[model samples]
Target: MARQLRERAEQHTETHLTLRDLRHVCWDPVPGAVVYVCENPRVVEAAADAGMDAGLVCTSGNATTVVHTLLTALVEGGTRLYVRGDFDWAGVAMVERLLTRYPAQPWRMSAADYEQQVERARDRRTPLQPLEGRPQTASWDPELAPSMNSFGMAVHEESALDLLVQDLRQRP
Candidate 1:
């Protein structure tokens, strides 16, 4: 039997994402198309698993330099962005900041929605981390921040994956 040699491909700095990477892939310019945005990668990754096409973008955390550029491109192309973040002070702040740059809708980011999820989490014994820092008002839904503080628990996007996936799977 001949011995088989398995060689791993070495990765370099050039392997990372760059402006040029997007140039070759011809994405349809769908103005006003719904683009699902998430603060964390897991939520967006699940959306990908559920077969989302070209309209999903995950910030992975706070909007970095690259994120700002990508978001600018999407908005400039006229895609409607719907963003959902963790239910915490930082989350509210992130949404507030994004609103200044782009017109993004807050998906599943409301007082009623948070309350419902909190109830479900309590019933299922899903451990929730406490909300951190002082709260900030959500410009899109003024009630959202107060409601989150009233609940005093952080409900991450991962907790509401199934519901979000349903929205993504719907055919308009």
Candidate 2:
């Protein structure tokens, strides 16, 4: 299944795998493998559109059981996960959950990344939606939550597609 996903990725195609598909599949550990995981499908779409031959996964919001199953298999296979999501409170919470539950790293989801995206929006005269809901702390990066609080703006994943795509391009 992982090899099939890789083939689809090589062809720049989007492949969705379900829990049933993963139930009987055996995953061989891929040493030094890197996969980009995000909350939105747009990042995957953008990477595919750019013809990037990188392993990309999207949760399409809060991860479901299938997502967790896939991630667990990936982690067991020694794949390094780089995770990113919207800059809103819920997004932060989702990221925090993944970071804690899995061996994953933040991908362009630092205080600097949030600030950069906020600045870019300001520069383009684009008004970002004010953040709603209770604020969530970013345990992976201590300063990220404070920075987002300071701005009180939500930076959706769409706004950071360029940087995300660039990161995908630079994947080893």
Candidate 3:
């Protein structure tokens, strides 16, 4: 299922994973290896297109049970998770939940990253909509939520796609 998802993105690739399929799939991650997690699959697709031989996973929003299963297996094998998501209330909630489950390192879900993307979105004239719903604290970056609320901006992963792809490109 993971390999199938890694192929070129198609319009109809939003299928859910079954526990049976999850049980059979195996990725014996190297000890102390790093795996990248993102909310949007586009980030994964972009990284793959950049020829990144990376351990990447896409949660496709709130993350499914299959994602949790995959993450658990990777952590048990000593793989560190580096996660990123949309810079919004929902994004923060998702990150907080993941942090509670595993000792995952945050990727671009930082106050600095949020601020920079907010500026970039402005420069690009992209609509900076006010963060909706209740704001949630970032378990990884303490200041991220306050800063995001103050700025009233949400930075989606696409804004930092190139930077993430660069990280993947430079991976040894």
Q: Which candidate leads the pack in TM-score? A: 2
Record all residue pairs in model 2 with backbone atoms less than 3 Å apart, i.e. clashing. none
**What 10-residue stretch in candidate 3 is worst by lDDT?**
6-15
Give residue 136's error in model 3 in angstroms: 0.5
Q: Order the candidates by lDDT, highest first — what do you get?
A: 2, 3, 1
Superpose all Cα atoms of candidate 2 onto the true structure and report the RMSD in Å to 1 decimal.
Answer: 1.5
Candidate 1 lDDT tens digits, 57-151? 66777887767777787788888888878888888788778876799888888889899999988898989999889888888888887888788
- Report the number of the highest-lDDT candidate: 2
Which residues of candidate 1, in runs, are more than 4 Å off? 1-20, 23-28
TM-score for each candidate, following the candidate numbering: 0.83, 0.93, 0.86
lDDT of candidate 3 at residue 44, scale 0 to 100:
76
lDDT of each: 0.74, 0.90, 0.81
Candidate 2, which ten residues in sequence have the lowest lDDT sum?
Answer: 1-10
Q: Give the TM-score of candidate 3.
A: 0.86
Q: How far out, in Å, is residue 81 in model 1?
A: 0.8
- For residues 128-157, write the lDDT of model 3, one tens digit per residue: 677898989887778998898899877888
lDDT of 2 by residue, 98-165 (tens): 99999899898899999999999899787799989998889988899899999999999998788889
